[model samples]
Target: MNLLKKVTALLLSLAIVIGSIFVGTKTNSYAATSKSYIKELKIGKTYYYNLDGGKYKDKIKVYVSKNDNLLLRINDKTIKVLKYDYEYSKHNYNRLPYKCNVRIYNFNKKDKSLEIVLNYREDLQEGYRILKFKNSKCLLDKIYNDSYMEKYDSNTGAITLSEGNWGLFKDFTDAIGRFGCYYKIQIKGYKIYNPYTSNTTEDARKFKYTADKNLNAYTNTNSSKIAFTVKRDEKVNIYSFYQKGNKKYIKVKNSSGKYGYIKIGSSPLFEEWLMVR
Candidate 1:
């Protein structure tokens, strides 16, 4: 009886050990399954499409939930619902009506890397389409004028010739007379600010130009003879004009009034610079 009791107790202990191991394995598997393969995207995160390998063809909005489901909205339509499964190294899904011909990526917040692959079909015959967003925000770099001559005084940070000399010219001809009686100025390194500011107010702004009808070309300062014509509705960097030592020269200006000179006679002034605002 004594031996039998000892054997019975040994079996019970062995059984408990085996059961504990089994339970641990199951718990681990369940935990792994609960994790999601796709990384969570924050609010306002966007995915851009590659149309011709040079520009963004389209964009998609990513909405992440606490339950690990990813919601994809394209052109205001909810097109995809992905389940987050963490056990696998990669997660992939396919659906129909892939009009944008772009891939969806899981935006990883930790390393700022996209982890998932999103593929779509496209038609080459159609030219690249521009992505439209109703209330989305985009990042824009600040542009500065590099070609103008910058001078720093004790009171002012950097003052260009155009900003200081524009007042010197009583009229448009007076400004032109300083530049050998020519009606054009060359500008370079025009910086485009993301959120534009003015002397009176700060607001969203883009680059713009106003030129006389005779001077319609627009180009970066380095390029020869205005590479393109300025459109009335197009956004442009403001090129500041100033005079140096009683001579008139064109310069690109920053918001701070710092200016850079552009080549003379390279492009004609379409109108008096006054109309550019």
Candidate 2:
């Protein structure tokens, strides 16, 4: 009996020894093989980078220079993709290079797919573009358009356009409508938001803020609410202002021009959601 127990102990010890060797070798192997492809370059308060961001960097030079206009360099191919919001940009923001950062948004080796999000600084996303690559080449360069971005429909995860029954969906987007063909694009990282209800300008106060929250229009300054629950994305006009205790509230008119009291921060202090000529 004692001999059998000793044999069992020996076997257990040998198994543990083998396990440790396997784990130790794996750790060292991974340490030796693992690599990072992104490099950050900062100049004063500004930032730039060089990225092995998948296909774009596979056979060419891919990096961002410290120029105020963020220049994306791919070999001899350079594109001015982003510009900080300057005074001149305000008048022609739509016509200028969008605000963006230099980074690897995505990469995949098995599928040979690479995706990138050009995050623009403005609240309006109509100017942004997402670059998609397949098999070491660019497959699609899609810009943000109302008709297409809304199709995402609150799907904040990676989605591909390859498998779709879009029918005549091309009629909506600004992209050249190509029937019987679809490009693969990863749509998860784009910062999607409704332009009607949310503030879009860099200076929130400079732009007319809208009602982003579902609020109750009370009969008076009291906590009691009326029958109306101000609908989402509806225009709110301040009829008057009032203060109760340490809190401030506003008397606002709904879409029907019906006056009721709404809690402070529910309506904009400036113009409406869209500037009225």
Candidate 3:
């Protein structure tokens, strides 16, 4: 279950790379995009201001819910996007006022547009977004950024969206105030590449791995001491161990070699992201 949350969060981060990452043999299209009267700027300067987004991507940021303003400044005015308790036109989910955020950073001299990423959620459900500045205004072209979806539901005292498809915006379009999926992305002058790199040593690689699934491996037959747990698959080492009652136990070691124990048969290898160097 936790694995679902981790994977969904990951998928949301990679959301912006959708066209460039997943198109495979097909023609990769762009993510969510927005267009407004271009905001002119002066050379050799930077600006900062709070961001306010409305509906999907394109719409007035001012005079709207200003709860979750992550701050986006272009030139002199703040780019109001990334709104919490925001309403959607095309989204039909179980939660209301979906919690979403998009932060702009890493100014690229080559492209001249700010790098943007988003993470959206409803309670624990997942979603994400991406944006690119065109030296003037913001536009939603692509959507994919799993990094932002990692939020903790303080009320529940657990990782929010810890498990689910995060099928937030399954029907995003360029239409104003209407988006299909929350992973909707918008980019301008971005490098596209194969998300996966071909490496002959991949299969043979082994190192620290994140706990993709919830697991507990104990120490002795009495199980008095807990060896380690692969919870959330936080990179670990398959240390050493023995068996009890025809059942095998695995000694778990952290990157520091601190060890623990758990059952040998945990989540399948497919569920765990094989720590690759």
Candidate 4:
């Protein structure tokens, strides 16, 4: 009887230990599977998401750049998604990366916070409904259509584009009508109620540099499409840095005064082929 009792106690203890381990593993798996929205978007990171409230069952892989340009890989094809607002872009026809001007106005004195507005010069997304969300929950808000008008308030919210008459099929070449594609974008990394401004001047003299070797400059971030080439020790003006997957590219203007992207090496060798000015 004593031996049996001891065996029973040992078995119970082992079961408890195993149960704890099982519970821990389950918890970790659940935590890992928790989906993150666009607000958590980071450069050089890929996000897995579904479209139209999961109405489309296909899992899409999204890649974002510092400028909020999105690349979606679905059904074994890559699609370029640009922002609805692209008034500032002058020369670029294939507008992958979207640009918008964000400004704060103290127009309404009744409200404690300053009024935030997004200015768009283009009429491409005129009637499109802007779905605003707070903490991943949808919020009923009004978005005014004006070049310079008070639209949003100083609040951290996710702005998503809902399906309208002007669908992504017009912009994307893959005929995105079947996928119910909607853009999930948010304003982040910008200080609210602060005077923030981005210089849009075509002056490349600000961040000028010289190529250490003969490098091929592409029209887009993908090194496949060579727009131009920079000879060794040729001077170029770098506008900004963009990331596509693990590769980095600098938007630069070669000596010919044409804008293009040059592949800057990854990590430690990012500036290996460039002589910084």
Candidate 5:
């Protein structure tokens, strides 16, 4: 009986030793895997490109979000990285060739190198409105002063406005009023906001306008009949507009729910008669 008890105790000890060895091996393996994954991905961290011996390399700051979305900040402008169709690396780590507007930057994990490719113009999608500013210096000069000039798509007959242009147009027309000479342009399909600000498109069909002086609303572009009379300092909402023989006409609705057409112009004193609100 004594010998059998001793043998049983020895077997139990051996079994406990084996179980510990297996558990230790599994724990170590798991720990190693976790460490490697942490090293591979550093989400929400800003990374600098100082690996290459290039001037002005540190000027660009890149950040990757928790969702693996990359963003770049250059010249005080933040550009979001977009997926593009281009081969970058042999391993294609996170799909290297990423597009940021007119420039494409590729990242390689193996050598930790960044490659920047620049293009003169951006690739425009269909149905983008190309603004041909009519004789206004501020609006016209924006085309050249901007980082990337709007591109005209010959096939679509539209111009691709940059993200900066969207903000500029919105601020000029809605917030800060255009000065010196009034800006006049033919409204197209629909108006869009800054993509970063709002995901939904604005019901921009009607833009607010204030009457500087009392004016008569015409029944039609060519008709002598009057539909209504807009009072001075009265506010109206513009629904549509058109150009006719050196004059521009806007279809508007007054606070009284009365709809009529008002004429607008490009004269220096045009804002005194009517201004966009």
Candidate 6:
């Protein structure tokens, strides 16, 4: 009977130890999974809370549940319970309505950084609606026209153009339209000179001049000292020009395919300094 009692006690002890180990493992696993969700969040990028169990690095299937909460960190500061009680499915995780407000700083300059804040709720039934924060405006705006251009001046921080006139623009838009065709600047009457040739004028003749592929050119007079050529009948956008003494240098391209700044003149074929809108 004593032996039997001893065996029973050992079994009970083992069971208790196993239970404690199981509980500890479960807690650790939960912490690990939760930590993964909050890792590598950019300061100003918005992220939705996903309740489904999945990895965070890639697109993960998530299912929303009422008990799920999102942990957020901004500017190295921990923010707990930014979003709560959100439910989602793996396929429709992004459709769920818990959203954070993200702002991009210095987007015009080279140093672009993000700042994010949680100030909105996602309503799946009603689509996404932005909840305006105190003194904050909505980020997204509707398109007013089919073709539009907006220009901002860095010098004065003033918006100059909503549409019309490329000359008023400081920078060119990189997007292409459906037609896949646009305008460019064309240059004429520019002379190419070679500094190395003994007969400078004659040597200039020897260097076969060609237009650049993009139908643009740079000037030899600038600090860059780069000469670009352009092909004939090709279009290019014109920016600023360089001027020295009595000569004004305009950026252009040649018929043979080269791009750079060229001197403009009244030659019949190379008559007009033209820019396509």
Name the TM-score of candidate 6.
0.19
Model 2 misplaced stretches (Cα beyond 4 Å): 1-69, 77-99, 107-110, 123-128, 133-137, 145-277
Q: Who is ahead in TM-score, 3 or 4? A: 4
lDDT by residue (18-57, candidate 3, tens digit) is 3212222111132212211133222223434222222223
lDDT per residue (tens digit) for residues 1-277 in model 2: 2676446534533443343222212122122211122332222232222223343343223344444344443334334343443334545655655344433433333343334445344432222355654343454555543211212212333322211112212221111111111222334332222121111111111221244456678887765868477765555544333433445555566767677766554333322221211
| Model 1 regions lying over 4 Å from their true place | 1-166, 169-224, 232-235, 242-277
Model 3, global lDDT: 0.36
Give the TM-scores of the predictions, in the order they appear: 0.19, 0.28, 0.28, 0.28, 0.30, 0.19
lDDT tens per residue, model 1, 148-258: 112212121122211111222323323222111111121111211111111100111122233333233324444455534434323233333433443343443433343
Worst 10 residues of 6 by lDDT: 173-182
**Candidate order (TM-score):** 5, 4, 2, 3, 1, 6
Query: CA shift at 128, candidate 3, in angstroms?
Result: 2.7
The 10 consecutive residues of candidate 4 with the worst lDDT sum are 172-181
lDDT tens readout by residue for model 5, 145-208: 1122223222222323222212323232222122111112221222212211111001222223
Q: Report the error of model 6 at residue 3, Å.
A: 99
Write model 4 residue lDDT over 31-103, tens digit each, in one string: 2211121233332344443322333433334354455454333334434342422333533566534344332
Cα RMSD of all models vs. native, in order, equals 31.3, 24.2, 18.8, 24.7, 27.7, 28.5
Off by over 4 Å in 4: 1-205, 267-277
Q: Please give the lDDT score for candidate 2.
A: 0.36
Predict model 6's lDDT versus the native. Answer: 0.27
lDDT of 2 at 156: 38
Return the top candidate by TM-score: 5
**Number of clashing pairs, model 5?**
0
Ten-residue segment with the worst summed lDDT in candidate 2?
196-205
Residue 47 miss distance in model 1 (angstroms): 72
